[model samples]
Target: MIDGLSFSLLTPPLIAFTVTLILTGWLIKNNVLKVLDHPNPRSLHTRAVRRTGGLGMMLGVAISWASIPAALPISVSLGVALLVLVSFADDIFGLPVLGRLLMHGAVAIWFSVALLSEARGWMVATIITISVVWMINLYNFMDGSDGLAGGMTLIGFTCYGLTALLAGNESFAVINFCIAAAAAAFLIFNFYPARIFMGDAGAIPLGFLAASLGMIGWTKGLWPPWLPVLVFSPFIADASVTLAKRCLSGEKFWQAHRAHYYQRMVRSGLGHRNTALLGYILMVSAGVSAMWAAHEDIAVQLGVGIVWGGIYLSMMIVSERYLERCPGD
Candidate 1:
């Protein structure tokens, strides 16, 4: 048998990955629970498929996080739990937009006040609070395509976890790593021609954690605030650009549509597997550059960002032209 301390260090990620596998298997096998996501104008999937994979992913994280007090504080876990419940309801009953956003905002407020109690200024606290809400929503928005969200979660958290470890923040590292592990396990079922979808339940809570843990890392001086931005730049760039376009065009941003860049690419004839792999390439590039920049001076960090920014710009333009030539709608 393994020694206690050593075993404990390995427990969170191991248990999360294993449980995710088991839950995914069960979810796929139990046809009664299959929340077949019917096809729509915005949907990439043509047929109904299970949408309960979020339960698998969230269950793994929830069970493992509760047991690892050293890695994830109870307050953070509570915030995740609240979002998961609200999102789960949204998945089942088609929650009203305003109500869902309000609950998300409430959770953001709780996080900002409880965690940043000694925040220097109310303005700072308010801004962080709003950012948290955006993080939660944007992630849910970006979960439209097969493999996109799971790949981002796996790559982004793995990068964050590794960087935190390098900075001597083992607690942050372990939590991040375990999340990444769970995401990886979930990806097996969520990949191209996905057997299941993550739904709002998984996307929302994961988004909140992405922001919350990034902030925690920053506060602890474990990593720079922009580090998370870099690690998740692909999703951030895609979601931010898509939101801006919708605002400029005066569209109802909350309404589901296939306007997102990743969605466009898939609808534009680039298959799901190809678009997902391209996303993976971008993710790895951003993550590797972020890790490298962590060791360099401020100027080098900016240069790294600029390089990635240019790449993102190129992708956006390419996607646009491709869609213009072969419009999906």
Candidate 2:
């Protein structure tokens, strides 16, 4: 038996994993929500798959978060609930993109204002609010491939939890660990030939939490703001760069396309499994470095960011060159 195992740490993740596994299995068996994701021009998957995995994953996270109420703020919890409801509606009824973005912006602004209060100016709040919205949409943008989003969630939150634990913030650590564990459970069916997709219901709220929790931790002094950005940079870099490229080419940047670096890798013969595995390697490396640098001085943290920026740049250049040589339809 493992000695010194605290129930506080063990119980929440256990609940998260068990709930996600069982619910996901049930969703697969029943197709209860019946939100089928079909192949599209931008889709990576070839056939229709049930996208109800988000219901199971978010349900598990909600249950676990409820169990550890002290770890999260009431406002953030409410924001997540709002995102889930609106996002699930979008999945079912296909809500207008503008309307959905409005809702996203509203919640982000509210959260940012509450988070900053009188401590910061409107300019700072505006930037963070925009960032929160970007994170929400960017995560949705990056969820096209198998195992990519789930793997990022697992690694990113684990890094966040570990950083909080190192800083002696047990409640915050448990909150993040539960999310990571739930994502791990989601990955059981999401890897490679995926059985289900998280859909908007799952991805939007998770993106919100990723930004919200990271900002919360920064405000609370548990970790630097750069740490969260670094940990989630895999998704960030790919989505932002792709968006930029599309805009530069005078393309409809908001419309879906296989322009993302990872999507290109998949189309360029990397396949889903290898692309996901390689992505896992990048995610783990980024998260580990972020965690380590969180405890270092300002100079070291800045250096870490610069180094990772260079690495991401190199990877993108290599991927673009490889794709130019093998341009897949």
Candidate 3:
């Protein structure tokens, strides 16, 4: 049985959720920071919303993670802190892209080496490093809409926690669940017509965890890399396909635009709430399926992959046709 889930362990994330909720409310009420994210062509929300709500989630994670007496590496904690620090500063001061990217690259390299410690070959190191960095960017790219990123985190990490439990890795399970709980709390204020956004501070660190923790579990033999990819497939498929299409069309991939499948669905008249809810449904389905299929044999895993592939392909085909039919809607 997945015995790592006890009331004591659950308490931390519960406390985190409560604190995050209260803290987010306080920020919204006080308008804590004067800085706001104004609407541009790419924005889903039309009004200026305070994006500092990421602070609450950060606080929740910090307090709860501190409560855990586990002996995780100090360097890992330091790297995560640095990422949040840089992202938070950028959220407030709008730091230059080059500097932010440099910081991201530095942290990515450190963790890439740590995660790939078992196989120090240059090719392995280089590939995983690029993958982790891409995860960070892809996550940020997918966070434009309300509740989208938060919901994905909840589902994705919870799936990770479940897989950890199955692997008898109680410590990893608790950590993943804690992150999920905090994200759930953030979702309270971040849902459709959000009063506050998570901004870079929340998004960046979360993206880092998604890749790092996923790799950690893989290294430990808790789950295969494909499992995490399937766990976060909704996001992976959307962001990767969009990025590829943009590159193929010679578009400036670094620039922001309302081009993601989720964004396009919203712009095509689905609205934020519907699009977000549908995305959540897909997340839950994919996560649950991955969680169940992780224990199966390689043949079973391959079969699962093929089925999901068809499903995603069907979605792409149907969505494209539906949008075309409603081009002026």
The parts of candidate 3 lying over 4 Å away from their true place are 1-5, 325-329
User: Can you give the TM-score per candidate against the true fold?
Assistant: 0.94, 0.96, 0.94
Q: Give the top-scoring candidate (TM-score).
A: 2
**Candidate 2 wrongly placed segments (more than 4 Å):** 1-5, 69-71, 325-329
- lDDT winner: 2
Candidate 1 versus the native: TM-score?
Answer: 0.94
The C-alpha local distance difference test score for the whole of candidate 2 amounts to 0.89
- Count clashing residue pairs per candidate: 0, 0, 0
Ten residues in sequence with the least summed lDDT for candidate 2: 320-329
**What is the C-alpha lDDT profile of model 1 across 1-329, one tens digit per residue?**
89985576588888889899899879999876746678887788998878788889989877777667674555578888888888888888888999998998888888888766545667877988988988888998889888999999999889888898889876678788788888999999999889889898899999998888888887777777788888888888989998898888888877888888888788778889999999999899889888889888999988988888888899878777768854423
Q: For residues 200-286, could you state the per-residue lDDT of candidate 2 as single tens digits?
A: 999999999999999999888998878889999999999998888888878888777777888888888889999999999999999
Q: Residue 176 CA error for candidate 3 (Å)?
A: 0.6
Candidate lDDT scores, in order, read 0.84, 0.89, 0.84
Deviation from native of the Cα of residue 287 in model 3, angstroms: 0.7
The residue pairs found clashing in candidate 3 are none
lDDT (Cα, tens digit) per residue for candidate 3, span 1-329: 43555865687788788888889888899944776899876687889999887788888887887777674555457777898889989988889988988888888888777766665577877877787788888898899888999999999999998889888987778888888998999999999888889889888888888887888788889998788889989999989988888899888888888778888888888988999999999999999989888888999999999999999989988877887644311
